[model samples]
Target chain A: MEILGYITLTIFVGAMVLMLFRKLNFPVQTVLVVVSLICLVLGAVFRFFSEGWVGVILLPNEMIGGIILHPITALLAGLFLAGALTASGGFDVLKVLINKLQKTPIGLAGTLVILIQLPVIASLPCGRIIAAALLPLLFAFGFEGGMGLLTRSQLIVLIGAFARNAFGSCGPSPIGGVGQIGEGFLGAFFPTASEGMLRAPQAFSLMLGTALTALFLKLITMKLYPEGVSLRDLPEGSVIEKKKAEAKGSFKGYLSLVIFVAALLISIFQPFGKMPVQTILVAGGILMLFMCRVSIRDLMSGIILLPVTAMASGFMAAGALASTGGFEALGNILKGFSSVPFLGVAGMLAIFVQIQTILPLACSRILTAALVPVLYFFGPAKFDLITWPQLAIVMAAYMINATTSCGPSPLGGGGMMAEGTMRADTGYIKGAFTFSSMAIMAPLAAIYMKFLTLSSFSASGVQLGRDVWLIIEFTLVIFVANAIIIKLSSKVLSEDVDKNWLSQLPAFVIPGAMGGAILAFCLYEMAFLRIIQGAIGGIIASLLIALMVPKRLTPAETGE
Target chain B: MDCGTTEWLTFLFLMAFYLSVEIYQVLRRKEGEIISFAGPDIPLGDLLGTRANVRMKDGEVVDAEMSGCTLCLGRFEVGDRVYVCKNRDKYVVSLPLFMKGRRKRSDFCKSSCRREQASIQGL
Candidate 1:
């Protein structure tokens, strides 16, 4: 069984690498399905050599058992609601409201800041829906769109930050979110784990990470690679072009939006008891059809098949691996790393939690489904390397890293949508995306999980009262350190591609070291040596991530 | 974070602490006001953008013949699903044209507007 697991793991890793490279031109989900069959066949063959035909029969059931339905239904429901919103003019209503909001004390940039946070607040299952819906409106704020409300820089920052938040929103979504995958694993210990045990930590880290992303875009991306950005600055001495008003919303738009919000609230709070989230979302969609006058055809049009297919197929492959004992073999292999003197158990966990971000996938669901169970095995009940509470902390960090991994993926990722809107080169914003996730969000999430999320939500009631100050201190340190890095980098940042690459060396290492050490400390409490191991682990991870960022600008970028 | 609770307050605190400071610094330096345009709707009825064509500088808001829906004014990221409405009798763009077979008209608008439309159906 263990030998088969290693073979299955090899096949899985090779298939994922193949999917990441676009040279084959096959769809990712299709590749996942093919890999599942290969793993199953190998598993069946191994079983035949050992236990004959009877052992092979149960492999199919084990593979089938891996399919998780919660996120799939939630994704479908989210699309339905989004479709209704578009059909019923709910988005127009939001635009009108946002425009009005700009006049309030928050001012334009402040209003835009809140606007960037909307996807996370809405907690949509997919980022593209809201990104698609709002990105044009963000463009409308720019000179090209003729609103002339925001400069090219502000527009880039606004769209980029919003995209950053939107892509990661799925990590904390209670309704059919990818976080539910981890929550299900955690539920074995914490009874209330499903009640968004990971929400606040992800949300907290993401908010800060997003702000740093905006800063990085403004300071580093725009300055270092002006040629990379395609949005033209206002012509010299040209007066800003006159613009026009936005479309108005009707009563039905308001009512429909209200329904969407109500459905989200009900799903999150579960006010009527622990009904399946599908029931709440589908019920909301049905009510919108009747009350909001949205057509069923329009609702049907909203359901995107790609993400759903990606998730379902990913589950099938993961199930195949589990049935083949692939997870056990993978865990053993990873645990073996702890034997190295410099890479203790804490260091291994730090590296493990961050591996998804280190090698991002197009949709986080692909790797997350396969890896979280392996992470589950690291807990006290299985390997005894970490307690349940420590596992929760690592889960928060891992899940956020996984959710945001898609943002930097060059393979048709969610961040690509934002890049298209910005008209920048394909990999222009990747460095910022990778840096923010690795250096800021991961450690911030770990600390939040330990201090706040676990303190309140854990079933065993671990009181982490004394270290609450760490949260405040860590938040301030990350914010200040990242700000100074961007500020100093801004000094040497210019259009020279090679020079810009040279400039990023320090930016990647410093915060990454702090991030890793902080992550280790959060997990190990007072173990100084473990903390050093974590810093070494952080430095190594940061170097790999930094290397992956494109060193050369594309021809179009250089042309501009 | 929950609404109106300490957790919610904490969320707002973090948001205010980070976002407000960052945004205000940049925004306070930015040189513009809130400009509004036809709320992502292809301008219709009394509000057509016959002179406000959202294309290249040399192009007029509407084509010479002024055929079909003349409300063609919007922007989008490249390669996205675009709303392909007619401008000057000829289709002058090349992106993934998204003509939802069931929609009321064949005329397209901006990719973002169309992407927003398709985002409902596509994503």
Candidate 2:
């Protein structure tokens, strides 16, 4: 079973890599299907050899069980509401309302920050819904979109940062978020885990990561690969007339917007008792159609099948792996590494947490679903590699890393929407996104959980006052180290293959190693050997990760 | 058939819904807004020298100017770029007349435009 699991994992990863490098030419959905089917056949073969006919018949039970329908249904419900909003001119009303926010005393940068983080703050079930709503608004700040509020460089940062926040917002969302998967697993031990065990750490890390991503976009992506950026700065002292002269919306538009807000409030507050969110959203969508004169076609067209289908396919592959004990095998293999002198348990955990971030897919849920179970197995209930409190810290790191991985994915990532609007070639902002996830967000999440979040649970031998300072100190160091590396790398780097690797890889690896070690220490370890092993483990993971970072810097390097 | 009732229902619902959308789209397909090309009937009424998002015959919307005001064949054509200012409730486009076939530009959009330089920034 272990060997079969190993084979399945290898084949799954190999197929994805083949697709990613363009060695295999197929759509992302097709690629995933191929990977899943391959894993299934492999699982059946292994089962047949091990336990004859009975095992083969039971193979699909575990495999099929991996497909969780809650999120898919939730996604469809969210899309339905989004479509109705679009059809009824609720979006237009929103545009006007958001447009008016420009006059607030908070000023441009402050207003921009609020708008960038709004998706996460709202805690929508799907980030795409809010992203679709407000991305046009973000673009309007650009020269191409005709508002001219920001320079081209500034526009790139704003859009990129907003995308970073938007794509990861679902991680902390109360409404059928990907983080709920981790929370569900954690509920086995922690009584209050399901109430949102992973939310604070993810939210905290994502907020800071979003800010760093903005800096990275401005300092690195735009300057490093100017050709990828299709936007131009305006001439000095030129006047750009506003694109929408009136910025007015109709009565129906306003009515739909009101209902939209009402829907959000109802879902969040659950005003009418604990009805399923899908029910609320679908009801809201139906009301929108009637009041706003929206056709069913308009509602249906708003649905994007790509991410949903990708996740389902990912589930298929994961199911095959799980049915064959692939995750168990994977855990044993990593545990086997504890015997290796250079990489101990801490180091192995570091690499494990950062792996999904390094090889990001279209949806965070894909890898998160596969790996969180294995990470849970590492706790005292299983291999005893880490305690429950320690597990919480690691889980926090893993959850944030998993959630934000989508920001850097080349395979139909949500960030691609921002890239399209910005007119940058694909993979333009990938470096900033991956580097921050690996170095800044992962360690930051771990430290935050260790100090504050896990305090409610009986995490022994920790002082509040000391831990608070340590959190601040660690965050500053990680933030400064990463920011310096990015800023310096940007100065020398170009978007081409050779130029991109020249400094970027080393920068990523060094910080990734540091981040891994930091996470190990945050697991409440003061030992020298564990820390060194953690750093070494981090280095190995970072190397694989650094190599995986996209090499396309220029428009000429657009296609795989 | 292999999955649960929810999955079956979801699958069926999506198929029917999308099929209907496709049918609706095909049924409702129509041409772009057909302005009268400013013929004698309309007489280019206050549309001259104004920067309007005019759809070309190819259906590409461009910041366009009316070719003639007086002699008035009265159709919109794409130009180097357009600058516009408010004219009562309308916006009149100010473009450098293409007297000698387009005043020289800087090769391509340097990612900057006159439209992005103004103070109004978001939304």
DockQ of every candidate structure: 0.03, 0.03
At residue B48, give the lDDT of candidate 2.
12
lDDT per residue (tens digit) for residues A1-560 in model 1: 78899999999888766645433333456667778999999999999989999999988998999887656666656655666676677878887788788789989877898889988887777765666566546767777677787776777777778878887887887766888888888889898887888888998999999999988988887776664444555677888755743747799988988988999998888897666566567677668778888754444333333455567777888898899999888889888988778987777877777787777766788788878888888997678788888899999999898998876665541122222322122266677888889888999999898888877884555546565787888899888988998899889877667777878978998887878888889888888999998888788788777766765433223344
Name the best candidate (by lDDT).
1
Clashing pairs in 2: A149-B121, A231-B111, A232-B111, A232-B112, A233-B111, A233-B112, A495-A553, B50-B93, B51-B93
* Residue-level lDDT for A162 in candidate 1: 80
Candidate 2 chain A lDDT trough over 10 residues, lowest sum:
A413-422
Q: What are the runs in model 2 whose C-alpha is more than 4 Å off? A: A236-239, A242-246, A269-277, A286-293, A412-424, A457-470, A487-500, A549-552, A555-560, B1-123
Q: After superposition, how far is residue B55 of candidate 1 from its true place, in Å?
A: 22
**Candidate 2, residues A1-560: lDDT per residue as tens digits?**
76787888787778766644435434445556667777878878877888899988887787888776666566556656766776777767867876677788877777888888887886766676666556557667766667767776777777778777877887887655777778777777898786677888888888999989888877776665554544557767778785752467899999888887788778667876765566667678778889888765445433333345545666676677778777777778889987788888888888988888766665677677667878888998788888888888999999888988865565431112222222122356667778778888889999999888787665465677887898789889989998888877877775465676667778878998898789888875798888888899889888877775544432232457
Q: What proportion of the true contacts does each candidate reproduce? A: 0.00, 0.01
What TM-score does chain A of each model score against the native chain A?
0.94, 0.87
